[model samples]
Target: MPLNRTTHRPVSTNALGGLYVLGALLALGVVWFAEHWLKLAPCELCLWERRPWWVLLGIGIVTIVLPKRYARFGVFLGLLCLMTSIGLAVLHAGVEHKFWPSPAPECRAPAFHGGSFKDWMSAMPARPNKPCDSPDYLFGLPVSMTELGGLYAAAVFVVALVGSFRMGRSRR
Candidate 1:
C-alpha cells in the first residue's frame, strides 16, 4: 500500500475526498478574487448564477466535516452544484449574446440614485445590462458567459468525480 505523507495511515479514501473539497474551494477562490479584488462588477444574472456556488461552498465545507460514511452523499451534492452553476452560466451567456434579454428586471434598466428618504424607499435600480459578454477571447474563443460558465462547472464536476472514487472506501 502507498504511504501517507501526513498521518501515516494508508491514505484512506475519506481524506482524499476532503482534499477534493479543499481543491474546489481554492478554484472558487481564484474566481472570487478575480471578481471582487479586480472590481469586475458582475451583472445581475451573473450574480444569480453564483447562487448555487454559494450554496455549494457551504455544502462542501459541511461535507468535509461530516462522517466519511456520507462521502458518497457529498459527491452527489457536488454534482448537483456543478450542474446548477453550468446552467446559470449558460443563461448569463445567453443574456450577453442578446439572444434573449435578461429575464431579471434589474438587467433591463438602470439604478435609482435619488437623494431623499422617500426616494431611497422607492423602487431601486432595475438591473443594468451586462457590461461584458465577450470581453476577451481565449484561444480564439470569446470569454463569453457560456464558455466560462461551462468551464467552471466542469472544474467543479471534476473535483466531485475525484471525490467520488474516495467515497466508497470509507463506507466499507
Candidate 2:
C-alpha cells in the first residue's frame, strides 16, 4: 500500500522483488520437472544456463529483505543476474542450432574404442551425457529449452525494468 511520491500511485518494491523470486523459482521448477519427471537429460551448456537463475533467486530474496532505501541495489543485482542468464541462454541456443560450437569441454562426446563389455560399462557415465548441439523440446514444441529460457529472461527483464523505473522515480 505504499504510495509513489512522484506519481501518487500505489506501489510496492517488495511486490516487484517477489516477481523476481517467483519467476526464478518457476523457471527452476520447470527445468527440474523436465529433468526428473520427463527424463530429459541436460547438456553441459544447458546446465551452465541455470547458474544465473540460482544467483538471481538469492538476489530476489535479499531485495525483499532489504530496506526500501537499499531495495534498488537488490533490483540492480537481479537485473544483472537476469542479463547473465539471457546471455547464457543465447549461447546455448546458438550451440543447439549449430550457430556456433559450445565452449564447454564437457559438451563434446567421448571417443570410445573397442573394449570388453565390462570396460565399456565402466567407461560410460551413470547418467547419459547429452551433446550441446542436441536440442530438447518441451511438450513437443519446436522451440528449444534454451530459446524458451532466453525469451522468458528477456520478458522478465523488461517487466522488472519498467517496474523499477516507476518505483525509483518517486525516490528522486
Candidate 3:
C-alpha cells in the first residue's frame, strides 16, 4: 500500500496529515521499541540506518505545525527522507551481509565523524560496527535489520506521497 498522510479520513482536502506524522512516529517508536522493549542494542549501523526516518519525522512535524499548504512540500520532504532511508538501509544491509564492508567510515568518516568528544562518546556504542549486522531480535523467523529498515523506508514513502494530496495550497 502506498504511504499516505492518513487514509482513514475523507479523501477531499486530504487533511489527514496524521498518517505522515504517525509514520514518522512509528519509525521513531520502532527504534525505541527495539532498543528498550526488544532490547535490540542498536549498533552504529542501526543508528545510521535510522537517520532518514528521523528526517522524515522532522518533516512530518513541520507539516503538522505549519500550514496545510506546506503539506505537499512535507510530502516531498518525506519522499526524500524515504529514499535516503532506503539507500542508507540498503547500504547498511550490505554492510550486514558483508556485501561490501562493516565499520563503515561513517562511523569515522570525516563526513560524519566530525564532532566533539561527547558526540564521539555518545556514538561509541555504534562505532566499530556491531558484531555482524545481526538483528538483536527475531520475530517469527530470525528477523533481519534490513527488513525493518526497508519497512520504515516504505512507510516514510507512503506518508510523503500521500501528503501530495494536500499540495500547492497556502493556508488561507
Candidate 4:
C-alpha cells in the first residue's frame, strides 16, 4: 500500500471523510439502539453529548461532497466537534462516577417552595429528568455509555488528526 510521504500513514482524504461519516453514524446508532431497543433512558448530559456527533455527521457529509482541496478544512472542523464530544463525555462520566457534581441544572432535583401541590405538579416537566449518575450498561460491560463515548471520540480524534497531518503534508 502507498504511504503518505510526510506522515507515512496510508490514509487518503476520501477515506478520512468516510471515516468521519461512519464514526458519527455508528455512535449515533449505538445510542439510539440503547435508548429504543435496550430501553435505556438518557440523562441531560447524554442528550448534550449527542450534539457534537450530529455536527460531525454534517461535517462529514460536506467533506465527502467537497473537493479534496477543501476536505482538510472539513476534517479540521470534525476534530473540533470530536473534541466537544470528548469533553461532554468526560463530564458525563465524571457525574456518573461521582467524581464531581453535574454542571447541568436539569441534572439537579427541582426545588419547590411555598407552592400549592397542584401548582407544583402543573409546573413540573412532562417527563422527569433522568438522574445523571445512574450508569447504563450495554452487553453487561462495566463501562458506562458515557465512558464508551469518550473513548470512541478520542480514538476518532487521534485518527483524524493523523489523517489531516497527511493531508497537509501532501499539499506541500
Model 4 lDDT, residue 85, Cα: 95
> What TM-score do all the candidates reach, one by one?
0.65, 0.84, 0.66, 0.90
lDDT for every model? 0.62, 0.86, 0.63, 0.89
> Which residue pairs in model 2 clash with each other?
none
**Model 3: pairs clashing at backbone N, Cα or C within 3 Å:** 3-158, 4-158, 5-19, 44-126
Tens digit of per-residue lDDT, candidate 2, span 1-172: 9886754553467877898899899999989998999999989888898888898888888889999888888888888889999999988888888999999978876567998988878877677779999998888899998899999999999988888877877665
Q: How many residue pairs clash in each candidate?
A: 4, 0, 4, 0
Between candidates 1 and 4, name the one with more favorable lDDT: 4
Candidate number achieving the greatest lDDT relative to the actual structure: 4
What would the per-residue lDDT of candidate 3 be over residues 60-131, giving only the tens digit for each residue?
Answer: 677667764555566666677778878877777776676776655544434335889887677555435445
How would you order the candidates by TM-score, starting with the best? 4, 2, 3, 1
Q: Which candidate comes out best when scored by TM-score?
A: 4
Model 2 quality (TM-score): 0.84
Write the number of the candidate with greater TM-score, choosing between 1 and 2: 2
TM-score of model 3 vs. true structure:
0.66
Which stretches in model 4 have alpha-carbon errors above 4 Å? 1-10
- After TM-score superposition, the amount by which residue 44's alpha carbon in candidate 1 deviates from its true location, in angstroms, is 0.9
Residue-wise C-alpha lDDT for candidate 1, range 23-137, written one tens digit per residue: 5566567558757776656666766766776666666677767775674576577677778787877777776777776777766544667588778656655443455443423
Q: Comparing candidate 1 with candidate 2, which one achieves the higher lDDT?
A: 2
Which has the better TM-score: candidate 2, or candidate 3?
A: 2
Q: Which of candidates 3 and 4 reaches a greater TM-score?
A: 4
